[model samples]
Structure formats: C-alpha cells, structure tokens
Target chain A: MKDRPLILVTNDDGITAPGLRALIEVMNELGDVFVVAPDSPQSGTGHAITSNATIYCTAITIDEGDQIEYSSSGTPVDCVKLAVNEILNRKPDICVSGINHGSNSSINVIYSGTMSAAVEAGIEGIPAIGFSLLDYDWEANFEATKKYVKKITQKVLDHGLPEGVVLNVNFPKLKEKDIKGIRICRQAKAYWEEDFDKRTNPNGKQYYWLSGKFVNKDKGQDTDEWALANGYVSLVPVMFDLTAHHAIQKLNSLGFNEK
Target chain B: MKDRPLILVTNDDGITAPGLRALIEVMNELGDVFVVAPDSPQSGTGHAITSNATIYCTAITIDEGDQIEYSSSGTPVDCVKLAVNEILNRKPDICVSGINHGSNSSINVIYSGTMSAAVEAGIEGIPAIGFSLLDYDWEANFEATKKYVKKITQKVLDHGLPEGVVLNVNFPKLKEKDIKGIRICRQAKAYWEEDFDKRTNPNGKQYYWLSGKFVNKDKGQDTDEWALANGYVSLVPVMFDLTAHHAIQKLNSLGFNEK
Candidate 1:
C-alpha cells in the first residue's frame, strides 16, 4: 500500500491529555495522521460547537512526529468540523476519535464528546470510530488496546462502513494478557441513576452537583456491558438514527388523529 | 386536577425564543410549569455540561405568568441537570424541550441541543419530548402547532412513554387548514452535506463556517421526513440505545478469543 491512508485523529480529552497522546501514538503506526482536538479537556461536552463565539485554531507541535497538529478553542465536534472543512485538503480515509479515559457504552454515548467527534465524521460521510477504556485514570494503559484498534481500523478501511453508522469501541481496564479478545456487541440497556448532591452555598443560596451511578438493568449477555465485564473489548456499531421503528407502528395504531 | 402536573419546560433557542414562549403557553394550560433554560441560545449544542467554569443561575420574571422561570449560564443539557437537581424539589411529571425553530428530524437529532435536553431527561427516567417546527424563522407560526402539541402532551400524560424512550415531534410549517394530521414514524436516514465557507480573517489566517444542505436519501415512506412532507406532524419514538442489535450476530462470527 504505497498510498498511505490519511487518518484524522481527535479526542474529547483535549490535546494534552494522556489518553489523546496514546491515541496519537497508535494512529501514527497505522497511517498518515493529522491531529485536531480541543485546547482543553472536554469530557462530557457532547456534540457542542462554538456558535455564538468566534473559534480560534493554532498549529502546534506535540512531539517529533510527521503528523500535523492543531489545537482549537472549540468542542470536539468543532474540531472534526474544522478539520474536515478547513484543515484537511481531502476527506481522510477514516476518522478515529479517542482511546478515551472512560467508557461510552450504552446510554453514555448520548453524553460523550469522544463519540460525538466520530459521529460528526460519520455524518459527513466518513467511516469513523470512537474508542474508550473502562478506566478513568489519566495514566490508564492503552498499550494493550493497540492491536485491536489497528485490526478494527484496518477492517473499516478495507470495507467501508454503512452510511450513517459509526463504531463505538470500549475496552475493559485490564492487563493486555488478561483481556479476552474483541466482541462485537449491542449497547446495553442501561441508565444513570441521578443522585443530586444539594448543598447550601456560602451566600445562603442552594446549589447542586450532578452525580449518578450507572444501573444496567438489561441482562442480555450479548450486550456491551457483558462484553466489557467478561474482559472482552466491546465494539458496537452505532447509527445516528434514534428512531424506534417498531414503536412507530404501535404509535400509528393509536388513532393520533381521531380528534 | 388542582394539583396540576409538574412540567419542566426548556429549549435550545434560549429562554426568550418565541418557540419556547409558545411551548410555555401550551404547558401553562396543562401544568404548574417550571422553566430552566439557557440565558442564551444553545442551538447545535448536543449534550454538553459545565464543568470547568462555575455556572450562574438566577430566578427571572420574564412575563406575568404563573410559570416560574430560571435562566442559567450553561448548555441545554445543563439546564435539565440543574433544574432536576437544584431548582425543582421533585422530579417533574414530564419534561418538554423546544418547539424549536428548525427540524430535529432524522440525523439532526444527534447534533440537536433541543433533543439532547429531552434525551437528558429521559436518561434520568423522566418522560420527555422535544418539539420542533420545520421552519427556521424566529417568528414561525406556533398557532397551528399548539393544537398538536397539546394533543401529544395530553396523550403522553395519559400513557407514559416506555423506558429509555423519548419522543422527537416535528411539525410541518403549514397553515392551520393545510396541516393534514399527526403520524408516528421512524427517524429518516438523512444527513447534512457540509460545505465549509472558508474565509480569511484580518490576520491572514483561514477559518471556516460550518454550513450544509440536508439530504434525505432514504426512500422509506415510514420516516419522519415523509410524514412531515405529507402535511402531518411527525412523532418519532427515539431511544438512547445506540447499539445495533442486529450486528451482534455478524460480530460473533469474527472469532475473537482471549489471549
């Protein structure tokens, strides 16, 4: 393959995050890499873009690498948009985001900035993937995830993904040897049980911190949760289409127009 | 019915948008409304939350209505988080967002702050709906939409939505008489064809504005786009599960194994 694949790399963990550095290292081995990510940590900052304010992007050197890097004053989605629209001269063969510090399995995808970058690329007619690990530690080991990441990325490059679909890959935090291979799975039926910590501010006003414990109610062994818990890296092919097709038929039968 | 349903209302178009006002008026007839919305427009801001900066919120009197309003310095998702956690004493019976100025049909749901608010509430186990009009004008007619909004809201009050599912309701911008009826449909397979408008700043650097035309390639008549085009109010039951359950079997065949 004399024509090296062009890979656009980004992350929700900002440019300097250890997770991003790990991701960059992995992508460097695979293709002609280009890095465009937020200037600051943007965890939990889903698909946000800078609309009301002007965004500024600057080129910076991350290390002695052939890849071009830019730091942006925008969200993860913005970084993708900027890269595709302003930076990249041509559409990259594939767009890969994260190797994120935490998991974006199940419903967490809705609030994940890492996945949003990939989703944005998918929306733009590019094959994209978002990778995350179960551990939230800054020094979480990503060395173990490289082979699987490369395999999946190569597969995606070889066989283009279906339109509007992207892959969400989450790895369980374990030593490389302890990891049970990769399993393609569905997102688990799970939700956050919100426990708001309310406290009085020093000014005698009340404030609250949003906190929650994840509760996975679905017992399907074929789900991302099961895959991760069993030490398998989970790969869920996700689509941006949120429609419940089966429920539509049920709703149509409700005589919504009977009035 | 003196104990009116506790309805938490919000929007991506800011607390002062006409669309939010219309939603507030409709909810006022059904419940004791509590509005916690962003002080500024938060369009295109998916599920972002404020973590790096201290958020400021204050009770504000926008009009002479019994509905209580609070403006916050955060994203639409943050509004939901703040409202449910700090402002309201109890979980709302229903959380309604938008009456958005533009359509959140199809893949737009992924980038929509309007739908993100509803999805956020749904994640927290609240029955939620995000409403939008096909028109993108600030002064789009909400008169005809009110009837459908009320009808849908009433039905939701009567029949609770399924767990992990929310509704994305989009109304075709038509005259009251031109409107056909409401239809429950699946999300259309559509995407934005992004064409970045590149321009140079005074500093001689190039930047781009993200702009695009929406393209609906799906021929399915059972989609939200089709329903809206046929002069009907489209309601798509959306789920937070991003997993493609059907793909699991194919992945199982890949022969992944433990090291």
Candidate 2:
C-alpha cells in the first residue's frame, strides 16, 4: 500500500481564521497534514522575509484534527522557510496556502502574503497552490471552494505542476452547486488608486491610513478578473521571473551600451 | 523657461544611507528631487503596504541639498505610494529606487523592498528604475557608478521605457575604468537556500534568525548574473505582471476544467 502524501498547509489570515480551519478540514482528508502559519493576520504583507529579528514558532492545537500544526510570529514567506528547513522531518510532497479571506486575482498577487507563501514553496521546488475567496468578510463561507480545491490538489499530485509556476486559484462567492467550472486564466492588467485618509492624532500630528480602489481596465475575457466576475473559478499560473524579455532587443537597439 | 523634471528618489536601506545620499547628489543635477524613504532599513520587505496602521511621513533635512526629503515610518512600497498619492503636487516625471547596498538580481528581486518601490511606482503608471551595486559595504564607493547612472538616466529620459516595463540596473564591484559597457539582459534562474540559526534564550525558548546562501545554476550568458560576472553593468527590464502565459495552454490541457 502507498503511504499517504505529506501535505503542508498555511495561510495569511492567521492560524485561528475560519478560512484556515476550513482548509485544514479539507486537507486532513487528503494526506498526513502539517501546518505552520502566521500567529496573526498577515494580509498585504507581500513577499516579505524577516531579517535581523528573532522568529518564534510554537506548536499549537486549535481543534482536534489529524494535522499537526504550529504558529509562527513571522511573515508568510518566513513560515514557508521555517516549515521546509526546520519544522518538518522532510520536505513535503505538496504545499497549499490560503483559502485567503479575499481575492488575490489580477494585480493582487504582487501584494499578497497568501500567494507569497505559495511562491516561496515553488522556489523550493515544491508544487504549490494558493487559494482565495472573493469575499472579504472574516467569516466568509469556504464550503464551495473545498471540492474545487480537492480536485485541483488531486490533479497536481497526479501530474506535477510545470516548473517555476504555482497556482493562484480564486473562487467566486457562491454555493458549491452554483459555482461554475474552473477556467485557466492570465493575470488581468490592473492597479490600485491610493486614497489616503489623513487624520490628526492625539499629539496633533498627521498620520495616514492606506486605502485604495481597485481599477481593472483589462477587458480581456481570458483574464482572471473576467472569469471571476462572470462565475468561474479563476486559476492563474504565476511565475516569479520578473524579466521583461521582450524589451531586451529594444534596449539593445537604443545603444545605451555605448560610452 | 522649461521647468526641471520632477524626480522621486527612494531606497530600502533607510533614509540616511550613504548610497541614497550619493543618488540624491546625482539626481539633483538632473531635476527637482523628492526623497521619501524608510526611517529604518526595510530590505526584504518586498511589496508590503501598511494597512490598519498609521504611517508617519515627516519632512526633514539630511544635508544642504536642493532635493526635498521626507522620512517615512513605512516600507519602500509605502514610500512610493505616499509620494504619488499625497506628497507630490503632480505625478513624478520618473521614480528611481535605490543604488542599493546589495544585489537584487535573479531571485532576490522577489524579496527586495528596493525593487518593490520601483514596481509600485511602475504600477501607478510612472516610468521607474531600480539600481543596485554588487557591494554590500556601508561606505562602498559609489563614485565609479555616478557617470553610468547619469548616462542611463539621460537615456531613459530621451527614450522612455517600454509599456509596463522598468529597469533593474546592477553594477559590478569594479573600478569605473574596469567596468565593461552595459549589457541588456534577462533575469537568471536562482534561489536562496535558508540556513536559519537556532538559539536558546534565557527564558529557555528557542528562536531563529533567518540567513541564506544564494545558489545559481542557470548558465545563460544573456542573464543578469552572467553580465555582472563579466565585469559589466547588467540592465534587466522588469515587469510587474506575474502571469506565466506560456504555461496557461498546458494547464488547460490537464483537463482540470471539466466538472
């Protein structure tokens, strides 16, 4: 008989988040689970790694389950590093992050701790997936996402993901039956327009809270934004190579190489 | 009379870093400069933005220069956002982040706060560039880099970067005369292998400090790593879009789309 696959789980919404709990339940049915995630919500933390600071990772039990879990006072990227190097006995067969509280579609992936965990895993040669719900509420239901999540995990374990790519899977806020099939998509061209809320503190000093409106101008039907907007689960294959290869020839032609 | 170009300067190595001061001196000759950077070092913070926390941006004078400066209690990405949304009278003509104390080439870009600032500015539709020297010393000689910096900045001003692209310029730790001409290149495939140092405190609790060894296996001569190795300044055009478009077709063929 084949031994159960070792599955690693994590998230940006902390260990106690319902989203994490829901993911834990689904992952428990799949393999021998090991979870190490943030001790507090680390949303919008991006690909940050803690430096020159001491990180604390302690074993914890949130609820009775088959998974052995630990919580770390570190960023999502930190958690993945800790998991791969120090926590587990061996590198896991697969790693999954989130069931994040909100969407990480389009341009959100750049500023996402949830996706950062998955990307960190991918860099370490692990096939990884990051899942998100379109709803922002902390108590948002993740029931509809479980079946799709299970399906995708099976497919990944069945045939490993392409090298240097990780999955950015986002589900629309719908019931299990109401959800449409998944669509393979590309990241939509989008940006946030920052609108700072400047206020005077008790000391009569000004401080600003960052707030922004998501502006998606890409109308392409093949984009993640369009897929999620209509009804399908959006799956974007993301890569970390930021090189704009197409511009290299153009740059060479500009003759900046000359003194 | 024609007005000078507005230049926004920032870094991940803190507001008072010598590299930043050197960059300020170079930028002063070209245009009016606004310097908004982290009050403390924010290296490796990536694209993180402050949320649900008050950020302080204070006006300050580091030295007698025409460049206006502010120190922010935020990450590099925050500095760029605040500069664009609240501080500036108009959008900056160009945003240049860092003559960083260390390299952000290859996989390091994913963990770099310096490049994050440039990426954030690029997201806001500003022409942006991030510069780094191979040297990590606090007092590294930036003298050799000044002329090349001037030349590149002039070229960028004369011929704008391609749409959705920004430059990542990394100089080798060589004398000015020894430096070979610039080479437009692609990012090399590389990753860090974490080597966390575990320690026990007086409280009998174990903690870790993150450290790592950079490993590069890609032998492409057209890569940034190769360019830097050959005593040449490597110029890589970077884009913020994370989509792996080529892998989308292969993913679609996997048949996960079917219910």
Q: Write the per-residue lDDT of candidate 1 for residues B1-259, one digit (tens) a residue.
A: 5488999999999999999999999999999999999999889998887755556678998988889999987789888988887778888999999999999998888789999999999988899999999988998889999998998998888787877789999999998899999888888888776666767899898666667788999899888999899898989999887776665665556444423
Which pairs clash in the backbone of model 1? none
Each model's TM-score?
Answer: 0.93, 0.98
Question: CAPRI verdict on model 1?
Answer: medium
lDDT of 2: 0.93
The candidate maximizing lDDT is: 2
- Name the candidate that leads on TM-score: 2
Which ranges in model 1 have alpha carbons more than 4 Å from their true place? A197-207, B1-3, B203-205, B256-259
Q: Give the distance in Å from residue B154's predicted Cα in candidate 1 to where it truly belongs.
A: 0.7
DockQ of each: 0.57, 0.89
